[model samples]
Target: MKVEGGCHCGLVRFEAEVADGPVEVLACGCSICAMTGFQHVIVPQSAFRIVEGRRETTTYRFGSGSARHIFCTQCGVKSFLTPRGRPDAMSLNLRCLDEGHGLDVTNVAVDQV
Candidate 1:
């Protein structure tokens, strides 16, 4: 399925392709993930494309500095990130989508902390 999403202020928009079946998401217990309520829908980089406001996004990294946490500079909404577990993939924030788009989400709890 093709999904569309963006940051809160509409400063960052993107499109991604997910599997046609159920979309499995990850709910991490790490500090950032917990604080931001990030539900990760991991998809390959090739499956995600930035449609607008690429320069309006800010990239943040911490600790291991492997994952590239990208957020909107205007609204501070983290729409997606480069995940450490899947270096070549992007972890899209399920909440950032249009009302979550009614995806069949299965949240897998991860003790990343």
Candidate 2:
């Protein structure tokens, strides 16, 4: 299934090709994810693309500085980013996906790291 999403202010937009069935997502309890309420849908880098606003985004890194927390410069919404644990993948914020994408999301495991 193909999912399209964007930041709150519509500054940054993206598209991702995900599996066409029930999907598992992670609810991370790390400081940044917890404070921002970010639910993670991890996808391979080849399955994701920035459809627009690539230049309108900014990145922030902390801790080991491996994960790149990308946000819309205008709205400060981290719709997607590169995860430290999976450099070959991108973590899309499940909450940011546009409605009617037909994603049966389940198995929401919470992790504190």
Give each model's clash number: 0, 0
Give per-residue CA lDDT, model 2, range 1-113, as digits (tens). 89999999998999999998889888887889989988899899999999999999999999999999999999999999998889999999999999897889884757642
Q: Quote model 1's TM-score.
A: 0.94
Q: In model 1, which runs have C-alpha deviations exceeding 4 angstroms?
A: none
lDDT tens per residue, model 1, 1-113 = 88999999898999999988788889998889999899999899999999999999899999899888998999999999998778889999999987657678887999862
Candidate 1 lowest-lDDT run of ten: 98-107
Evaluated at residue 22, the lDDT of candidate 2 is 86
List residue ranges in candidate 2 displaced over 4 A: none
**CA lDDT of each prediction against the hidden true structure:** 0.89, 0.91
Q: Whole-model lDDT for model 1 versus the true structure?
A: 0.89
Task: Show the lowest summed lDDT stretch of 10 residues, model 2.
Answer: 104-113
